[model samples]
Target: MEISLNSSSNETTLLADDCWEFIFKIIISDDSCYFKSLSLVSKQFLSITNRLLFSLTISTLTPQPLLPSLFQRFTYLTSLNLTRFHGDLNKLLCQISCFPLNITSLNLSAKFTKSTIPFVGLLSFSKKITTLTSLTYSNIYSIHYTDFIFIADCFPLLEELYLINNLCGSYDNFEVDFSDSFTLYKLRKVRLKRQSINDELLFHLFKNCKHLEEAVILGCDGITDDGIASAISQRPTLKSLSLSDTFGLFSNITTHFIDSLVSLPLTKLILINCCKYSYAGIICLLSKCRQSLQHLNLLNADFLSDQHVVEFSLLLRNLVFINLIGCKMLTESALFALVRNCASLSEIKIEIIWRKSVQNPDSLMGFGVYPQLKSLYFAKSVENPDSLLDFGVYPQLKYLYFANNRWLSDESIIKFASIFHNLQVLDLSNCVRISDEISKLEVLNLSETEVDDETLNVISRNCCGLLQLKLNFCNNITEKGVNRVIENCTQLRKISLQFCDKVHNNVVDSMLNSRPSLRKIIAPHGLDLCDKKKKLFLSQGCILK
Candidate 1:
């Protein structure tokens, strides 16, 4: 047992090695940069950090021979991400093959076209790494059906596979008869994007991946409703399904498929941009999967109405995240119902696009509080978002995106700000009704709003912890206001002043001189500034664009 002397207490305490290791693991998982920085602090930290930073990511932009030394240094590396590697990917794989036992997860993003690089050569080395369970191969242009089959045969123990971009060969023309000669029985998850996949491929894929629990098929137009239904219906183990940007295949999800979805113990369902999906089919599906559904995202499902949302909310008590972004038919009434009922609801994204049908402010009279609701994105959705101001309390609320709420009056702003003690990110962009009365926040976006110098000053005073401030097109904010923000918000990292024609170079120069925590400045064009100012900004490591 290792013991450490507490400098402050002047007492020796037993240093729990397991606890320290757990903390270091969390730090590594959260951010690799910070974890690497800590390694350079001291020799003691280096040992711990090396252990925690076991997963290494290398890019082709780096020097050619960077791998040999890195592999030697981090022998414990169990995961590797080879991103945008333009160099000989086969050679890189061969190098990795030298120490194949440790790696469990490998991500390869090849720059070479399929004709130039041999998939066989790459997989030859990858196959040596028996521990490899997860593989993500992206942008490996021109991969045929045979190559995909070969990959499965090579990595029999593979559990997770992500084939992104051009990895699936020709989108328009490709043979479907890839025989079910190989089966990845252990395969649990498969993510396919921008692939030319039809019923035949999915039929074989689902048959082989018997234990498939999660499947994400995005931007694959060749996938028809029948193909998707047949594929998923075969995989009874599947609990989560995300089908986004799939050309009208989802538009007409049949009752048979809906029955299949309901029968599966599905906890998550994300349907985005599949505009053809009938409202009735979705509502019916939701009604069937109500008890099991926990996370549901219908982003850009324009057909969904207020009644559908209300009914869905009523049916599902376990829903934690619900995104109805760009659902033009939905209104505040449905959201109110969810808040009043769904006890586990934590995150919600609703767009009240029907401004003409915007409800009266009085409708928010007895709308109950949602104690679990933590994040809300209502940008450009509501015409009258005054109900949010009146909705008594949301103790856990941290992010509020009420942008384009033109009808949200000054009184509402003040009231909302006063109660949102945990509010960190607020986007009041295009909300002309906003006038001062700001909350202590980390991110504040007031773009195209009627925010003047006085409003900026109010934000500077209250939002001392502000990190990113956007004042784009706010002609009223001059040098004085920006200077006040710079001086007050010491933690400021980024400030956008695009199209704010009134703000000249002098204001930007003054801001740079202040030497606050500013990192990026998206200033307006035609500002008269000396080259010295630009040099000074560069010296301070600030991006002035």
Candidate 2:
């Protein structure tokens, strides 16, 4: 690659003082590179590019030997993202082993096995850090109860922590005690993802963190009826509460805690997997907390069948967001009943479930009442696409998410296309087959899913006002697919291609050069472009690839 040492005649202050400030602004503010590089020039570009080269979030280079260089140069980094950083936790431990004391937010995730993160090593990191505010260290195998007690001893200022997708086996197996309340007193949000958290520890959270608003204790096996009742009765100020994945919810637990929950005045309630309760449980919930519920996600609580849905339809009149994903027992009539009666319902997600498991998959029951519905998330396993006709003519639909279901075909798109003219966002991400019906769409996402260029071009043409287009992992579309859209769609802003094997360097070059309005391009690590060309393409102001 040639590095031009001389300047051109036409060049008139390509990068001024303002430009450098703007680039630094985006780098510090963490704005997408689309607008950031549009502020830079060709000269001294390589030196300035180093600012982006070491961001723990975007960069992929190994940090073993260069850790000190990163720590010394990027001293102003406010947050470090280590969620998907490659290799073992030892590598991860080494990478941040020298992080600057100023970095406040740290997101540690297991890109590898969770077991690698020994509790002692984690406790040391958490213990020493005094300014850390937001932390996500989740699912490092079965974290012993004593490990948490250690964490509570450390990180006196820790506020937000996500413990989702982890295994906390037999939480009652050990006794964990925090010596001082100073550590937990400042924690605002704690996520207990499906672990069996001891009831006493949870109450400790409620009792200490008087300012706690969000507490996610999904799938906590240690939470008995008494524990749940005690926590809510105690923390009356909680705004967002998630009790998902705790399917052990029986009628007795429901009867015990219904009144207790109603009194807490919760705004967000996620009660997925509470399948052990009767329809009366949901009914009692809606009957008591109808006015305050803003987002209630009750996906796949097996016990509440169509009858309970009917009960909820009558009681829940002010619900704004509801997720009924995997509620197989929810017959079409029940679905119809809720959509029809729940006037304030806006976002509803129904996930893919096993059809053969139900006695009757061909019933035409739940297609009744959706007057105020706007955003819908339809799962991948829905067999009959014709079932969507139950939406009863959606003219106000804005966001449509048809997550890959084997049974979805072009016919379904065509049918739903005519109904949702006001659709602003359409996510046919991973459907089995899409016909010409989608060609009429303006906003589409076939990312990490499947689709032919034929389906893509029609969308680019019909949806001239498209804002964000994602065609990632789609193998069928060649440069022709990209060209078809790039040539026509002027308003397109963002495109994501995480793993489309067919995409080559030439297509990427042309897309970057041809589309002037293109702002962001997110392609996962496999674009077969040369080193020189990749640098040249990025300097032109397109985002990650």
- TM-score per candidate, in order? 0.78, 0.74
Q: Across residues 1-545, which tens digit of lDDT does each residue of candidate 2 receive?
A: 01233366534246665575565555445543432443254545534544443344623465467767766766556577766655555445544644644556777665446453445545555544457777776554456556565666656677887765554433435575755443466778988776656777677667777778888887766667667778777688887887754556433665558777878777788876766656666677767787788888877766656677777767678778878777766545565666777888888776533445455534544545566888766666555557666456777777777766657677777778778877777776666465454634456787655566786678677777776788777887776777788888876768776677776645666676677667677763466556686577556655545
Cα lDDT, all candidates: 0.75, 0.65
State model 2's lDDT: 0.65
- The CA root-mean-square deviation of candidate 2, after full C-alpha superposition on the true structure, stands at 6.4
Where model 1 places Cα greater than 4 Å from the true spot, the runs are: 1-29, 84-87, 99-101, 110-121, 124-128, 139-142, 166-169, 176-181, 249-253, 275-277, 353-363, 402-414, 427-437, 443-460, 466-545
Q: Which lDDT value does model 1 have at 536?
A: 73
Residue-level lDDT of model 1, residues 1-545, one tens digit each, is 11234557733223454665676666446545445435544555666666666677777766757767777777788888887566677777877787634788888876555642346556766667778799888885544567667778778888999888865555666777765576888899899887767777877888778899999988876777778778877888789999876555665667767777877889999887877767788888888888989999888888778787777778899899998878887766778878877889888888775345545766666665557878877756465656566666776778877777777667877788776778888888888877766778888898988888888888889888887899898988888888889999887878998989777766787676684456678877676546776667766657677
Q: CA lDDT of 267 in candidate 1?
A: 95
Q: Best TM-score goes to which candidate?
A: 1
